[model samples]
Target chain A: MIAFRNVTHGYGDGPLLSDVSLTLPPGSFHFLTGPSGAGKSTFLKLCYRELMPIAGTVEIFGQDVSHMSRDAVAMARRKIGVVHQDCQFLDHLPLADNVALPLTVAGREANPEELKELLAWVGLSGHARARPPSLSGGERQRAALARAVITAPEMVLADEPTGNLDWDMSQRLLTLLVELNRMGKTILIATHDMNLIRTAKSQVAARVLRIRDRTVQHAGADL
Target chain B: MKAPLPRKFRLFGRDTRTDRVVPPSGAAAWLTLLTAAAMAFLAVFALALSVATGRLADRWSEALANGATVRISAPADQMATQTQRVLDILSVTPGVETARALDPAETQALLSPWFGPDLPVASLPIPQLIDIQETPQGFDAEGLRLRLSAEVPGATLDDHQRWRRPLVAAADRMRMLGLISLALIGAAMAAMVTLAAMAALSANGQVIRTLRLIGARDGYVARAFVRRFTTRTLTGAAAGTAVAMTAIALMPSAGDAGGFLTDIAFQGAEWLWPLTIPPLAAIVAFVATRTAALRSLRTVL
Candidate 1:
């Protein structure tokens, strides 16, 4: 449900992602792969309207990202879930409260049973009372994943979801993502892990895109 | 089956989840409270001064508006004749309510404070004084002065306007100054609150970023800070107002002491005015904090 038409972005320097045109259709699963500093995180930011494209237009759910007001951007974000590489959380809050934050910010009543089941699905049921800083890296990633899908958003954009996880933990996280895709949720993940890509391809029908030398290219059957 | 999640309490019509994200900045919180308290205390005094000066101006204007005094300075023998001539002139004046010359003993009473009660009144050269009372629509002092100068050259009419006008004007000016001081105090409080809120927002930059990333709107983020500062200001101002009202109540009454300082206090229903300070302080804090929070959130989110 996200479209970037010739979207060019930069940070006071030259363009990071130049003349990039891509479409993330509904119920589709895609992987973004490139080396370090290949503008992968920047691509996900544009998808969520965190950063506006300097050159062309970026659209989410058919609304122009650059034209949306601050409040409209926030409302649009509720429809798309984002899992960051750092797995940002309010360190002062417990893990359960952090995961329930999306519903809380939207001014909706949190269904305790649903929140519990979501936490259990991500295997963070026992760690609900724990703080973010107190949790292990892998546990934090799972908590982040649970938080992302807590709102039942239509699309999920994750930036290096398993950056800090081991091989088995990464596989487990991949399985959760695969299940979500099977349930008709669009998923786009950016990563540099080739093994994670290989594992994801065997589990689900997915296309791979890579960002290199300031442009996005469809990597053809290389994996 | 998964266990049910416990419901958290809602504060100020919103769930407390958003508020818990920002860690409390203890120093900034206390600074806002103390600033509000101090500003409120000063505001009470300013209100009192304005009210008291207004009363003083009204009293002076009413008492001195229609009254005049006739001072007769002449030879001892001619003083009686001049006084009689002045009295006769005043009796025909349309606005003159009553005119009576002061007796020797009454004149001595006026001088008792400076010359002691046993002053030699008969031998002294103090001028003969005649008190003149006017109707509600008073006579013209200039017209009467010309009449007395022709009929009784030694007689001089003083309608108390020379001194009364200045006294009334001074009181009115004091009232205006008191009001201006209250306005300045309010502005200063707002400025201090704005600075404190900005500091708190800056210190919690990470918290704001995290909240916005989770789809929290600017209003949601601003409310958390606004409610906190408003509550603190209200509580502190209440305490300050209580102390100020008690101090004002203990002040000497104007009727008993009869002086400027004694009159600088609340009288009757005027005590109810200071009670509004706490609520007003809360409003100021709400506006100041909301403005700072939203402005800072723009740069953050």
Candidate 2:
């Protein structure tokens, strides 16, 4: 449950996302679509409290993001999973350890069986012993997805999950996200890929919101 | 059904995976260790100096506090008579414990180092010296000086206060200087450790960002750096302390040749003091690294 109320954010210049208001309800799936440099990634950052709104308020789990302490922000992040466009990983570590990082940071032991199963779900079962730098682009994206969901967070926000993947791989990753949504996990993905959006519509019902002219608008069936 | 709890999170526990999150900073690690060793070596010497100077001060104060010297300078014919008169004055003094005039052989032995062994003591007009020991409650030197001036014009009573006070003060000042040197060494170690930690934190910025993305707190991130530095410092300091203690143990003892520099070593229970350097170095490293890590984490994370 993340809500942005009339949030306006920008770099030093003018606002890139202006007067935006949106609510991500529990167990709902949404897709953010826009042209390049249209503040889709910035919007995603606001949801996870990585960047605060310069104007208006951003709330995560009914708590104001601006008022939370650094420690409180970390605790709030445990409930939200984010997948970056580059799919960051601790390259020195093996794939299994990288995926189990969330549990480790939470000061809990990673279950070997659960990790094995999660790696299998992400099609990274064979690459468990391999380092992150050795994985392919699609494998790395899937591994990032596995890491995101390993904590069983309530909400998942992904930025350009399929930017570096082929069509087949993108569909595979989309299917994985659809399966998670079916299991009652709220999902919001930001991307400029129209084909991926059409494909996502065939698999599951997802509302598409397009960012244009520094504002978010609900793009109905026309998109 | 409930899951079982994990093992206790030990402060010194070895978690290879968690430690690997921040890559080993090879140069910084070696620098920290070497600096800690050097500081610890200097710290051991400083401690020895402090303890040795303190002992010297106490010895000098105790030996000089209750003693005085009566020097009788007279014509060669009246030397024995003047010595006899000085001894008689000391015997009647209230706080005089024992007084004896030094024999010619004893005076020759005292002057042997300066004038060599074969000096003709009977022919020369050397003054007669009477060694006087005082009671616990010593006699007043002013009163004794007036009496000696009135009774025997050639006799001067020196209570050794002027020389003894300065000697004791010099030793005490040396002890303070040793302590100040130790403090400066500790401060230098801390500064070096802080710089090394900052460099490591800056070099591992990506590692910190990745850790923060995964919901790791500042304390968790700081622990990785702190534990590494503290262990390195402790190990290095232990090695330095061991070497220093061995070197001190092999130093020449202060027996007959009681030169000040020769006695610059631990005495008796004082040997155990150097053993504290390792733990103290570890504590310094821990504090320095923890401070640098947390401050840098705030900026980067």
Candidate 3:
């Protein structure tokens, strides 16, 4: 669970998002939509403690994100899966190894069978031995997804995960996310694609939140 | 976080030793091996110099501190009389163990290198030398000198104190200088290795950033580099030490006509002393790299 109470974030002299109050409960599915530079990624980053709130409080699982120590934040991140916009991977490692990185960072053994099954689920079973740089955008996204879920985190946050995918590929990725939600993993996705938001709505009870005028608003009511 | 992970975790985790080895190319590994070997070679000699100087100081101080010589430079007829009188005085002296006049052949042997074996010592007015030996509770030089001056007016006493003091002092200073040089070499090695580690860390910024993005604690990331550099330094030091030891072992022994420089080597159990350098180097690398990594990580993060 995550709660941002009147949170305000900014760069040196400009406010990106201000007075943004929101709550994401367990097993909830939410879509964040906004135009370019709307602070969607920054908002998702705060959820996992990558960037701290400049003002106000961001809480995850009852611990204050801004107050948590570095180790505490790292341990907390083990329970939250984050897929970056670029779908970052350790380039030198094989795709399978990259996907198993979460388990590795957590100091847990990666079960070979479980890793194979996770790759299979991401449709990257054939690319297990392939290096991350050799994988296509879609494959990279799927691998990032696999990495995020490897620790069996309770929540998943993704930023434009379908940005480089075709319609069919986007749908396949969304279906994977929906299945995770069905299995009780809370999910929040930030995207600019309205079609993707509409598609996610029809499949699951996902609420759409739009960042406008430096504030988050319920999308259905406004647009 | 929970009671600190085992060293096995530190050892086998992809982050530490396995990740940084850069896959050994024969050339690179050999270069590392050679570097270690050469440094070790020099280090061994430095160690030997330090130990040998210490021994020389101890020997010079011990041998010269407890002995004196009496030389009588009179006519051959008076030489025998003066020698007998000096011996009579020494017989009553407190710490004089024995005083004996040198025979003609023994005197010639001392002068052979300078004046040749055919020098006419019987005709020329060379002084008759008395070789004096002393007990641990040595004779009073001033007291015996006064007695000899009164009894044998032509006698000149050489207690070896004037020359011995300076020789022992010089040896002691050389021993100190050798120790100081060894310390400076260790410091220089640490500084060089620290710079190398920092360069390596800077070169691998992407790796560090990736690790950080994945939520690795600073300690985990630091340990990766710390262990890496520690091993490199240890290996380097080991190679350096081995080459140094072997080269020192092959150095000319003092018994040979080897000059002082050639005679610089470990004696007795002094050889075991170089074994401590590798572990010491490892500790230095650990501390130096850890400080560099932590400082750099803090600045960037």
Candidate 4:
């Protein structure tokens, strides 16, 4: 669970999200819809402690993000999986190694069969030896998803995970998120895709929040 | 699943290989390795020099301190009488172990190399020499010289101190020079290692940034770089030491051949001294690279 108490975040000389207060309850799924430059990625970064809020506090599982040490933050991140839009990876490593990196950094040896199965779940089983630069956009996104959930984190935060995918690919990624939600993994996805949000809404009871005017408003059925 | 400890937190594990090896053309890596190798070689030479000088000093002190020569350069007729008087005086001394007159043949053998073997030693009036050996607490040179001057008018006592002191002083200076060379070698190693570590960190900028983004601490990142450089230095120094030892071992032996340079080698168990160089090089590289990496990472992060 994450709580942002009256968070006012902004870059120098301008406010992106001001006086925003929100709490994500345990096991709740939400969709954050915002226009360009609306601080959606910035909000997700705050949730994971990548970027501390300028004036307010963000809490994860009751621990203050602003006060956590680097190790403590890394440990906290293990419980919350994140899928960046670009899907960064150590390019020199193979796809399988990249997918198992979270486990590697955590110093846990991966069971080869389990890792293969995880890759299979993401439809990248055959591309285990492939390099990141060689993977397609959709493959990379799926690989990122596999990497994110490798630790079986309690919460999933995704920023435009399917932005570069085709309609069919987007629907597939949405299905993966929906499956994770069904398994009681809280999910918050920030995107501008209305069709994707509507499709997610039909499949599960996902509350949609729109970020505009430096505040979050309930978009409700209008989304 | 149980969370595992990070690499830095592990007490013991498999050796960590360098994550970033500069290509063969990597200027920094080659420069560091070459610099370390050169310094290690110089250190080996300095070690050999110091050991040699120590041996020389000990030999000169022991051999010269226990012996004296009384040269009786009197009128040809009185030479034998004066030699007898000087010998008698030395024989009565408490610390004198043995005193004997050197006959013509024995004195001729001492001059054989310089003057030809056909020297007319019996015809020419060479001074009568009386050699005196002493116990550990040797007879006082000044006391014996005073006694010889009163008893044998032409007797001049040579305790070899004049020659021995200069040789000892020269040996001591050589040892000091060796020590200074060793210190400079260590400084050069530390400087080269620090530069190499900085270069490696800069080259692996992306790896560092990625690690930082993933929440790695400064110590964790520093361990990787430090471990890599320390291994490299040890390996390089080992190679250098081996080459130096082999070169020294192949040097001409001191047995009637190569003169002083031959004696300039490791004595007895002194061979063990050069063995310490590689490990010492490792410790230097470890400290140098670790400090450099940690300091640079702090600024960058």
Can you list each candidate's DockQ? 0.69, 0.68, 0.40, 0.26
Candidate 2 per-residue lDDT over residues B1-301, each given as its tens digit: 9864432222367766567788767778888888888889999999999998999999999999988999889998888787888888889999999999999999999999999999989889888889999999998789989999998889988899899999999999999999999999999999999999898899888889878877888878888888888889998899889888889889877785877887889978888899999999999988899899988988743
What TM-score should be assigned to candidate 2? 0.94
Segments of candidate 2 deviating more than 4 angstroms: A202-205, B1-10
Write the number of the candidate with greater lDDT, choosing between 2 and 3.
2
Q: Which ten residues in a row have the lowest lDDT in candidate 1 chain B?
A: B4-13
Best by DockQ: 1
Per-model C-alpha RMSD: 4.4, 3.0, 3.3, 4.4
Candidates sorted by DockQ, descending order?
A: 1, 2, 3, 4
- lDDT value, candidate 1, whole model: 0.87
| CA deviation > 4 Å runs, candidate 3 | B1-35, B254-256
TM-score, cand. 1: 0.94
lDDT of 2 by residue, A140-221 (tens): 8888988998998888999999887888778878887888899888999998888999888888889999998999998987
Chain A TM value for model 3: 0.94
- List where candidate 1 sits over 4 angstroms from the true fold: B1-15, B254-258
Docking class of 3: acceptable
User: In model 1, what are the clashing residue pairs, if there are any?
Assistant: none
Higher DockQ: candidate 3 or 4? 3
List ranges where model 4 is wrong by over 4 Å: A1-26, A52-67, A182-184, A202-223, B1-39, B106-127, B215-227, B254-257, B296-301
Candidate 4 contains a number of clashing pairs equal to 0
- What alpha-carbon RMSD in Å does predicted model 3 have with respect to the real structure? 3.3
